[model samples]
Target: MLFFLRMRWHWIVVTTCAFLAIAGTYLLTAEPTFVASTQLVIFPQVSGSEAQRAFAEDAFIEGQLEIARSSDVVGGTVAALDLVHDPEFVDQTPSLQDRAKNWLTGFSSGNGANEVQAQTEEERLHDWATAKLLNMTGIRRIGSSTIIEVSAAASTPQKAVDIADTLARQYIQKNIAMKANAARQYSDWLSTFISEQQRGLADTASALASFTSNPRDQFKLAELQSATDARRSLYENTLNQLTETKQRITYSMSDATIVSPATLPLSKARPRSTLIAAFAAAVGLGAGLALAMIRHASDRRLVRPHQIAETGGLPFVTLLATAKRTRNGHPPRFLAVGTGSSTTARPVIPGMAELSATVVGLRRKRRVVIGVVAVEPGGGASTIACELAVLSSVSGAKTLLIDAAAQKSSLSKAIAPQSSSGLADVLDNGELIETAALPLSPTLKFLPLGRVDTVSPAIRLSSRRTQLSFVELKKEFDSVFVDISAFSASPDANAIAPELDGVLVVASHGRTSIDDAMRVIETLRNVGAEILGAIINHAPKSMQP
Candidate 1:
């Protein structure tokens, strides 16, 4: 995970920066909203302890909260503040949807519709204001308590405070009005009932007086007096109820009281800039890491040392760091190993010395002929072979470096560019190795690919004559390094690999895939080739000495 993070650090930084830019843009362009809240304490106004106990229930408190958020309360507040004309409640400018609707309907359609349209427009404006107020308003009961919280959000702190306070006031007034209306209705009903009772009492009293005037009707007079007394008592009770109901209408109280008035907000309620930016950064970083991991999983190129064995199951010979280019944009051809400079290329590479020593150990059997091959072109096989031969020759052994890769004779071009005959001529025309080979030093000799118009190295490399030539070269030189073509480029390496004493597989760092290297190794092993080890050449600076 850490490796991938380092490899794709720039991508992560870029993604995070892009998210931060979006957050900054929103912070700069988004409008700010302020919230103000008021609290109301609800209770019963009736003159009884039972009413108060019932009012303490959560249901009663919830009902009061609903009333505070109702359309009636919100609309009353809008009318009280004349919010229909206020831009915060109802925008004076028409929206694009409104304009489009008007265009589709054709505004100049009929006459005699002005007054009706004006009335409808006024009603619509009021409804819009009420709806807008309701949307911005929030009413909730505070826990299990009798207190209700009413909050309103607006563009300005003062507007938010006004809306919240006005809505609370309207709710209180509506409650008082409802109580007053109930009391007035009761008073009217009691007055009419009392008037009917008074008439009945008068008739009973009249009947009682008439019966007393008759001397012989004593039983009828007593019965009439009893009936009249009961009627008088009922009339007095109805009159008292009327008086109390009238008083209640004059002094009606609200069920809820303002315990906490709305106050002006100090900060915006939305668009938390810092938190938004932090969240965006986190999301972007995660996304970048996911992308990096995906890319890393798909990539098969070998970069580190452990991957050589883990991927291809091949023995790690050594890693050769790429040499820095000289002033002319070319790598130094042949700097000695013990030189003071670390910038130039050396003939004695990091692992080549050990490889040369291993080859020299094999020289006890008369002669050692080793071939350096690659899975693909540009794996620096020729460079490794040349360096190996140079190191061997420097160690006082008679070394012969052969450029048998006829397709790409890089060694021949670099060393024996002037030579006209090489292994190609030696294999085709029976030319001797000593005649075709050029002298690089007293101990080292070079064999170029020479002309190949008449001979193909892939077909001739595995021939009987080529095997005899190898035998003669082995008898003559103590060490022979053959540079074969890439296995992907031609069949020459496969044909020539088994004939050599041992073959070194060359793979380029960061360029050669582990699968390709493994395939080459498997092919060589199947062809009865004597495998020595492997070399990772042209490694990046991080893997350098």
Candidate 2:
């Protein structure tokens, strides 16, 4: 995670920007809504045992909640509030189908004249308003208690409050109406039953009276009196129940009561801008981190010293910081060295002095020849070779800088631009070696590749004549540094690799691939050349050691 965060930080910034854009768009275009709520308490009439009453109260509360959110209550509220004509309740934006239908209606002649068209439109509007009201209304019981909360949302605070209050009132009215209707039905039935009971009592009384007078059978007379008494008791009980039901209907008592009235909301309920922005930012950061990890996993560049050593199967040397080039038209300085006469110092190439020291320490003899090569082009091999030669000279050692690479003559152009003949002239053209080599400092000499367009033929010629020329040059110079082409580009470096004392491979951080570096090592090993530690060039400042 830390590696990805360090390497792929730009991806994080891009993902954050994308998230902010989407969140800003939603916040700007979304509609604001206000919510208002009212609380109601329900009380069931006690009529049975303790357990039965408790169960009945639970069932009653659940049933009331359902009724409160029912279509009947919502529909009544919509009609009472005249919401069919209200713009907030009705969707003013016409759909494509509605627009097409309106266009057709305007062009049609007989359809517009029909009376049913106007009635159908009114019915559609009413249905739409009822659905809208139901969608905005919410009803839920508060925990295990008999209290319920009713809430409604709308564009305006007043509308939200009005809808909540009206819903509660309509539910209470419906409940009362239902109970009163039931009571009225019971009272009517009881009145008819009472009339029949009174008629039966009169008949029983007449029979008893007649039986007593006749005195023909004592059992029949006692049976008639018992029948008359039972009829009278049933009549009295019916009379009492009928009277109570009538009183209840007159009073019209309801179980639901508004404990808290809905109040106007002070703020909007949805589209919390601050909270939404924070949540979006958090999501964006997480997504960015995930993307950075994926990118880091897929990258193939060798950015660390350990990676180069592990991949190339070689020892790791120090990293070299990238040097700044002069903007003005002057030759670039390689390494910083005191002039021994002035306090003002020239800019020294970073890491070159360290590289030269490493090479010196790795040598077993007093005088040694080291060839600097790279796996790929633009790896700063030539620059390091020149700087190492310069550092060796400043240390009072006779150093020879050879630009043997034929592809690019950058070092020759920078150091000995006036010299027209070099190593190639000495090997192929039979030119004098003393006349071809140019002297830069008192102890430093340079040999350019010398006007060679092709590298392979010149390397072959140098290989045949290398024993005589190289032995005499080694006798005069203390340390020899050869700058050659990239190993992958030509076989020139490999041809001369066996002639040098040791070979140093240069690799650029974040650009050189492990496969390329390994290939270069394998090529040098095939020729039985001595391999020194690798150097990382153009490395970041933090990676320098």
Candidate 3:
């Protein structure tokens, strides 16, 4: 986790900051909404067998729930509370997006304007409140039971409570009204039916009287009397049904009961600030970590010492920190040895002592010419070469520093800037090493890259004279450090690598990639250059540099 943070802290920081800003803006600008809920227990009004009742109970209760959420019920509640003119419902503030949409669409003069003009102001306001109420209300069944929960949201606690309670009451009243209307309709139809039955019964009775008075046949009289009795019985039954229907219409009841009433809410239900902030933080952190992981996986820069060995397949040497220059704009005095010791302690350059000791160990018991070359430019190969030469000379070894880079000789520009003759003169003009080499101390000699007018350093270094000059230098100096051009920049390092005892590859920390280091190592090995080891320069403080 720490590695990921260090590698991609910028990505993490940017993403986390952006999410936090959005969360803060919402918290500050968004309006709070309060919710209040009421519950109802619906009863099945079906008249049937037990099996039929059980089958219809669920469907009946479900229909009641829909009725509770219906527009008629909501509109009735709106009218009861006069919410169309209530300040909480009528004077609500519009959001920025809503205002912008209104502004953009306000200029239209079309059928839409005519449609708005068709409705009266009161009707329009009532319809708007009904729609708004529907949007704010929620109704759902409680488990598998006959109870249902209805909730409403508003900008204030009291308003929310009023809406919920009023809506529930309105639904109950609507149920009562529907039952009353059905009973009344049935009562009117039954009264008409009874009137027809009564007239038919009177006709039958009159026919029986006529038959008796006229002394008809005995069989006809008996049949007429039986018919009169049957008609009278049916008419009395119809009259009783009409009387029962009139009683039902007078005392119609609702099928639903309020199990709970809405109470005034104490807190806002929406814009839950704490949960929102935490959720935002979690989402932001997750997004940041994801991006960090992706970036870390794609990056190939070598930031650790273990990566050097894994990529270049070379022994890991000491890590070097960036060397600081003095106020005079020259290399630090530590680059060269001091003559006298001071009373106060001086800061030691990181990695120099370890590197010098490593070089000495590699020398074994004979003269060793170690060429320092970087995989890429600006890898501090020249600085390493200079330090090694200075340290070796101070330690009583006959040390010689040579700048053999054909293109942009950093060592020549920094160390032997005053010297006019160097390796170029020795290799191309057959100048003696004694005349070309400049002295920095009693034991250290500096050879700069003199002017090469026409001949290329590669061709010159490949000649027999360059090889003989290097052999003579080896016989003269106990240790020689050469600053060769980067392998990517020129082929001078390859040309001079075979002549040296071994070559030290230098790669910059966090700048050189594994692939680039591997390619450099492979190219040097293919040319038969002895692979000594590798050094990592400009390492961060977390490492031992």
Candidate 4:
């Protein structure tokens, strides 16, 4: 999270904009909906046995809740509201393809067929309205209670209220009708059973009368009398049940009652602007964090001195700030060692003295020849080389600044643009090296690349004569600072690398990638060049370590 906040906070605005766009679109396109709800309480009927009633109550309430959401209740509500004819409830406009198809059907069909089709279409519309109403309705039991909530949502407050009230009323009427129908069915079955019992009772009574009249067999007469009594008792019990069932059919009412009627809603329930905007903002924040992390993970620029050291397997020197340009547009100078005066036009970098000390400590002998090179161009290698040479000269060492980079000698142009003879003239044309060397200060001497044609310096620097020249120059000067071309641009640095005492690689912060720096390190190691350490140049103040 901190990484995102510190390194990639800009992503937040992008994500916020995206989320705002989506929310704005929804606000403009979506219709506001209002919701109204009605509550109903179910009471247990008193007709059944105690155990039967307890189980029945639970099952009954559950069944009713399901029925509230069922197609029957929805269809009844649709019929009561005449939703089939309402444009808001049913989409009357057909698509172009559908209109064309309908036209073709009417054109090909006879009048009778068209009438049948019209009836079918009406039925389809009715079914569609019922389905649509069901989608807009919600039914649920309120916790562990017999009460059920029926809610409806629509585009208008009145429509929502009407649908909710009408649905509850229809459910109540349907429940009453079901109970009455059940009682009537039981009464009808009882009536048929009573008729059968009456016939049986009459037959048994007739048999008993015959037995009693004959009086020949007492046991048979007793058996016939007992059978008649049993039949009469059974018929009386059935008659009592039939009377009770008939009374129930006449008196039974619906088990459910409306506890709260739906009222017109005061406000729309959905698409609340405040809630939607807050939610969109939250989503935007999360998306921004995700994008920031992704970008941070994929970034390859080296920003710290330790990162370059760890990546290239080299020791870290010191961080150097990007130099200010002089009036002539030359790179700035480093702080001179032990110089209390700050009269130089170029700004003094803070860590250049430390960098010079570290380089000086790496020297095994008094006269040290250090070549400065970079992994890629624009790494501030020339500026760093010039600064180090100045610092060494100010420290009272006889320092010679050598411009070995042939293609673009930034150091040569900055220090000695008008010099007719330089390292390039000496190496390519066998000119005297002493004539090319120019003195910048009593202790500091400068050697530029001088004028040359298309030939690359890598070829001239690779010669045995140039190698011997470096040996002789190292003896003449206490310290020789060679500014070489970037390793990626040419192999001139590598060609003269073996002749130098050590090489200091300069990497620009946020410009040189770890992969490129590591490649330069590997190439130098392959040539057996002694690597002293790497210096990070042109680092931002915030990035200094």
Structural similarity to truth (TM-score) of each candidate: 0.70, 0.76, 0.69, 0.70
Q: At residue 281, give the lDDT of candidate 2.
A: 91
**Largest TM-score belongs to which candidate?**
2
Model 4 regions lying over 4 Å from their true place? 1-35, 47-52, 81-104, 155-159, 176-254, 263-351, 409-423, 426-448, 464-468, 508-515, 536-543
Candidate 1: clashing pairs of residues: none
TM-score of model 4 relative to the true fold?
0.70
Runs of candidate 1 exceeding 4 Å displacement: 1-34, 46-56, 76-136, 154-159, 197-252, 264-267, 271-367, 377-478, 482-485, 489-492, 495-499, 508-511, 525-528, 536-545
Model 3 alpha-carbon miss at residue 196, Å? 2.9
In candidate 3, which residue pairs clash?
Answer: none
| Tens-digit lDDT track of model 1 for 1-545 | 66566666777888888888888899889989899999999884333376566655655666677777788899999999899999877877888997776555556644446556657778999999999888988998888777888899998999899989999999999888878999999988998898899899988988778778875777777788889989998998888888888887999888999998999898999888779989999998988777767767887876666776655565545778664555643345533222433321345355556666766777766688899998799888887888788778888888988888877887777666667677777775664666777776778888888888755664587777652367777767889999998889988878888888888888888788888888888899899987777888877555454
Cα error, candidate 1, residue 249 (Å)? 4.8
RMSD of each: 5.9, 5.3, 6.6, 7.0
Flag regions of model 3 displaced more than 4 Å.
1-34, 43-59, 74-136, 153-163, 197-252, 257-300, 303-353, 390-396, 403-468, 526-528, 540-545
Candidate 1 vs 2: which has more TM-score: 2
Residue by residue across 1-545, what tens digits does model 4's lDDT show?
55347557778778988998899899889999999999999986545888887788888888888777777778999999999998777897878997887778889997877788789888889999998888888999898788999999999999999999999999987887778889899989989998999999999998888778879988888888888999999999999998988887788777889999999989888889889989999999899888977877886777666676776677765678777777776654532223443322333665777888887775535688899998888888888888788878777788888887876788777666677877767775545676777766778878888776776554576667552366777778889898999988887877878777889988877677877877787888788788888877887665444
RMSD of 2: 5.3
Query: What's model 1's overall lDDT?
Result: 0.79
Global lDDT scores for all candidate models:
0.79, 0.80, 0.80, 0.80
Report the number of clashing residue pairs per model.
0, 2, 0, 0
